[model samples]
Target: MTTRARNVISAAIVAGLLLPAAPALAQSDEQQRIRKLEAEVSALQRRVFPGGDGRYFEPEIGGTSQGTTVTAGTPSTTALTDILARLDAMEASLQTLTGQVEVNANTLQGLTTRMAALEQSGAAPTLASAPTPTPTPAASSPSQASTTTANNLTAMTGGASSQPARPAPAASGPSSQRLAAVQAIAKPKTDDAGDDEYSYGFRLWDAGYYPEAQQQLTLFVEQYPDHWRATYGRNLLGRAYLDDGKAREAAPWFLNNYQADRNAARSPDSLLYLAESMIALRDTDRACIALAEFGETYPAVAAGRLQSQYEANRAKVTCTN
Candidate 1:
């Protein structure tokens, strides 16, 4: 009886232990399979999204109270790249427009300055007044009595036939007195109507009354075309236009001054102003040529401020050797 009982008891204990081990082994196997499936899913996600380890999830169609449907999506690389390219293009366009606007503004400013200058110079004369010609006096015959007396006297003196003395020939050129008078009128110390017109105009120019100065200078040139100071007047007139930002208009005047009288008092100055006007107009090639011509024409004039101005302008234009 004791052997049978011991065998049965041992069998029951072994059966219980075996039953618990089977369930535990099955659970472990199921967990390992689940882990393997998770690893595969992670690898698939990496392949699909490449940028991150997070899985992509579609928006759930939650219960809708209304008929409208809502949807959302992540921005794709291609769409984002297109948007960036558009933004870059817009920036470039904006930069180009800004540059053009700046150029236009500069041009407008120059034009305004030129207009102001033109207004200041007074209206140009339509026609210069010509000098009035002097009338020659008619020759008068000697009185009859004087002639008879001369004849009688000649007869008494037993002289040959007397002939009326020819009037002395008029003197040639201006007299010393006339020249002195001109000088006095041209450079008077007081501010009188008889003062030198050229000096008065030059003073006005120096004082920045460009319009009035130009008018006075023009009148002087018109009234005294043969005067030596006419050349200076022309030069100053051109300078007035140039200083007022009317370079294009100034250029023609300067050219005319140099062309009309190459040996005039301010011919070299006219050429220099011409070069400056060309530079202002952005004609660097012409400006350089003009400067070179000035050097050739007035090489001796290279000592004063003129030479320094030439060098500075040349550098500004980036002139070639």
Candidate 2:
């Protein structure tokens, strides 16, 4: 009931009010510290893994005393698995391609071997017994001269005879005349050696012995210039060079075959080979022109192998419509 008792009672009331406010202030400060720690963790996560949703810290589960642990995201796991699968698939594809390349190489080698064998066994023509002899002026009468001339013309225009003629022995004017007279009287002899030589050359060509084949064919042409097989020999020589991958060298021989004997059986064949040579030389325009000439000149015989060859070459050269 005195002045000191009243002051003590006022101080107690003020202390009661201040105690509740102090607990609220402490709780607010704790919340601010937690927020600041979360901001620092988020900034570190961004710097460590910029483009990925990598592992990051989460707020403690129960309380601030609990330890922070990393948890993986579903997207990151899925991305890693996908990358491994893609690498495996790429390895499998590369292995498959390598196997296919080896198989193709082996197949090509087998084809080449088989083709050479076939060519070697199938190229020679059957041999004949003998060539007819030229007529002698003294033995035949005037009326027979025309007939003899006609026969000579027929033999010249004819395709290759199965039997080639033997070369006459070297002689001067009178001796040559006597030898011719005797030959006209005597029966013609078959040149079996010449036929064998021709067959050997053709077999060489077929067996891919190109250099040897060229030499043999050239010798045959030179030694037996008037033989029935002369035209074929020239054409085959050109083919040997062409098949040997000497297109530029082959062109001249093919051209010579056609120019020297246009009416010969293999003349058209020579033209076709010439076109092929031109294509090998990358002269498409010239190849096309040569093909046109072949078509114009040999319309009668253009339905079989020659026609097929022309069509294939035309496509290869990509000729205009």
Candidate 3:
């Protein structure tokens, strides 16, 4: 009637089957009983467990003194019956697993045999394998659509939220070359003279020359070691690497800023860039720590305002056992 009853019947039949003195007629009767028991177990398992994952289970306490009542389909009553059945005849677990493994092995053997036959027949030679697919990088950042969407998201979601400081765009491209040819790199300006090189970088960045900008920014740092713009130069180079989908490349540049001169005006921006780089690299441990440090180091700065956001993000991070 129920799953447990069927399991008990099967075990009883198995015991009877093992009896050496049992007669042939009695043995046939025992086999019929076992079949009947297995059928009952299957039915009860379907009704109680119902699905692959939602299997029946029994609590620590055994069934009622009056014998466990199966209230048709109540979760506790019927499910308990199913669970007790499964637990009682633990051999069923091994049988089920073995059946599945046997089926799979047979199928695989058949497939292998067929394949070998075909290859010998020369109907489908070289069917053993093909080259695996190599993954290319995902789409690069700084596309018009991507920029617009990111800007929109930043504006809308973070109106009340703190805006993380961003490094300037990449500044190495054809424009930088034009600027180099037209203007002195030393007297860089927006209006005239070295304006060409200065403007060239921005244009190259706008044209998506992220790798080029990374190189130019490195050069800029060398040329203007004492200038205030040197800080921004390194910052932009890091961003260029980020835009080019190179998180590791960007990380060191940002980290350099994090440890730059404490008295400098760009120190806050430097820390901000470092944190951003860490986040991009998915190095949450370091990123959160960096943000917390940012909060302490620049207590009143806008970049320091990112403390709450970083903590909130940290709340969602978890280490699995």
Question: Please, what is the TM-score per model?
Answer: 0.39, 0.43, 0.36
Which tens-of-lDDT digit does each residue in 1-321 have in candidate 3? 999999999999999877755676786786667667655755666665566343453212223444343333236676678667878788888889999999999999999888656422211222223323332222222321244433332232124233123344546445767656434333334433222333345444545666555555565565555544444455556667777887656666655543444444445555555566566667665665555555555666543334444445445444231
Candidate 1, poorest ten consecutive residues by summed lDDT: 157-166
How many steric clashes between backbone atoms does each model show?
3, 0, 3
lDDT of 1 by residue, 268-318 (tens): 777777778878888876676667666766676644436666677677776
Q: Report, for every candidate in turn, its global Cα lDDT versus the true structure.
A: 0.59, 0.63, 0.52
Off by over 4 Å in 3: 1-199, 303-321
**Comparing 1 and 2 on lDDT, the stronger one:** 2
Off by over 4 Å in 1: 1-195, 303-305
Clashing pairs in 2: none
Which scores greater on lDDT, model 1 or model 3? 1
Q: lDDT tens digits, residues 257-313, model 2?
A: 765656666777877788888899898767776676667666754554466676777
TM for candidate 1 is 0.39
Clashes of 2: 0
Better of 2 and 3 by TM-score: 2
Candidate 3 residue pairs in backbone clash: 175-200, 179-196, 179-197
Q: Scored by Cα lDDT, where does model 3 land?
A: 0.52
